[model samples]
Target: MAAANHNTVKYGIIGVGMMGREHLINLYHLRGEGVAVVAIADPHIPSQQLALELAQSFNWPLKIFSGHQELLNSGLCDVVIVSTPNMTHYQVLMDIINHPKPHHVLVEKPLCTTVAHCKEVVNAARKRPDILVQVGLEYRYMPPVAKLFEIVKEGSLGQVKMVAIREHRFPFLVKVNNWNRFNENTGGTLVEKCCHFFDLMRLFVGANPVRVMASGAIDVNHKNEIYDGRVPDIIDNAYVIVEFENGSRGMLDLCMFAEGSKNEQEISVVGEIGKGEAFVPESIVRFGTRVAGRDAVQTLKADDDRIKYDGLHHGSSYLEHLNFLSAIRTKGEKAPAVDLQDGLISVAMGVAAQLSIEKGRFVTIEETMAEHKF
Candidate 1:
């Protein structure tokens, strides 16, 4: 990667929602180090005003616009963070990739709503080799996950044989109730929420999933409607199976309406020599084997040292932003940690898992790609 051109790395945010607000705070810190957020655009006036207030607090001149096109055409930003809803990722990404600005794009998770749209954004990025397109799978940037990848690749765990994950949380009815309740906007429960876990599964195994099968039901949320000849269309609880190209297998259990259930985004990877588990929020990794081939498990503790940050998380959004900026300076020769292609595959896996559940059969990632005509 080329050296970061800090002075020239200006960013514009296209969405001012929750993730957008986080990015704005990240850019605020970046601005103190010569990089800046020059423009912001969102459909909601309240969002725009919030962004302006945040920017103004830093005494930075941030221009706010009503639409993304205005922000792009203003030439105030060299990169655009497309943090809009999943349905709009395709259009907004295409606009950024096609613009004369050819600005680098940092899109939020899952890339797009469907495989076809994922392909569209990726193909456009491929055509413009000068601009970089990165997907925000922030978990990949987390320190614990990074360490997990290193340990797996370093053979500390020996050949990873099986991976299992559980993500159970309360229904997401509090925010965007209608859009999330239905599959029309959210792209089914698995794709809407669990793509991040899918991405991590791929990353930990260091292989793409070749096949997937899943079973799920709207047992708690929207169950009555689904049983009454009305399709709830969204899954609330699911059991997913994934087989990797290298013969490793994974099982995932996801539930959205489990009573008294806490958010469980934990993964356990069983390997030939040992097993490893990651507790995401706590940033803890436990690895070790049983005593002398006994059935008991052990925990290999990490150093537990923390890295210093300049007003950013150790797994900082600003660091990811800096990485994107570096990729742009390198003219696509430098690989982004999470690129458009990775984003597509992540979404594809989610799509396949959902399809497997709905069709009551195994689904190949290839079949999902074929449906997209890719």
Candidate 2:
């Protein structure tokens, strides 16, 4: 991608929380390189102050607003990045989509809190093809994962057989100050966080998931472990198995309460000819033969060979902004860094997995769709 021409693709960020601030910093760097962030909005006063400070500190002429509606109504931004809460995405998106100026939207992962809202967004986006509504599924932009996709597509790993992704984090114990904790608001653990992996699985297999089987329980984490003086429904850890249409399969293991020992967010794929594995925390890619006669694994430091940026961290949110600018400048023809339907499908997979866990049976994608029709 060439340098983003400043004439098009003016950027703005909404909800300046952790992720939103990261976007602001990324956009500051982009501004130094010709791209501009003309405006920003967040309900929190502290967030607004931070945005103003960033604009002043970086010598950028950016407007700050207290709410997303005000930001959209200002007509200052050509493109908007919705970094609001999961439950708030649908309404904010609707507001932007309905605006006369019609700015393109780059929404955060999971797209929305429910499958119905996801479908609504997709339908609305379809009606107005001019307004590009992209969902932020950043893992697809990861260099090692991108390389893995290339290898799989080029037959370096012939016919992917299975993929296993393990995500072990400290806990969801942190006070989110929003709807991330409650399942009704954030759509539970899978939809809130692990949807990235679900989407990645679909992309890696290059096929849609046929069915999902899952088993989960709230084994640990939380002061009030019991719901209403009994047991809670949400699971702290779970294992989900996804069967794809291409006769391939994927497995996801999530543990939000793995105290002590090394933490990891790892993904490994096995194919007929060879295997490719990536450990996100370690930033390593291991590839080796999986044949019956020759089985070996050789690891390489993926960080060393990554596409370097000026001031952007390896796994930061900056890459997505760069990709977004590229997409806008290049129109829709270029390879989508992240698209809307992909995000919707990812959330659907999570919803299906949760349903499978509750029902103790395999659930199809279609069944999930029918269950939550928009």
TM-score of 2: 0.89
lDDT of each: 0.77, 0.77
Runs in model 1 lying further than 4 Å from the true structure: 1-6, 173-178, 222-233, 258-263, 290-318, 329-331, 372-374
Candidate 2 residue-wise lDDT, 160-206, digit = tens? 88999998887764423644556776787888888989988998888
Q: Which candidate number has the best TM-score?
A: 2
The ten-residue window of minimal lDDT in model 2 covers 304-313
Q: For model 2, name the residue pairs that clash.
A: none
* Model 2 misplaced stretches (Cα beyond 4 Å): 1-8, 173-176, 225-234, 259-263, 292-296, 304-313, 371-374
Q: Give the TM-score of candidate 1.
A: 0.87
**Model 1 over residues 1-374: C-alpha lDDT tens digits?**
22156455778899887668778887776654456778888888877788888888978788888899999898878778988877778888888888887677888887998998898788788788778778888766665666677778888788888989887767765332244556767777788788888888888787999999999887877655533345567878899999999999988898887646443567788888878787655567777764345345444433223322323234446667767766776677788889777899989999998888878899999999885432
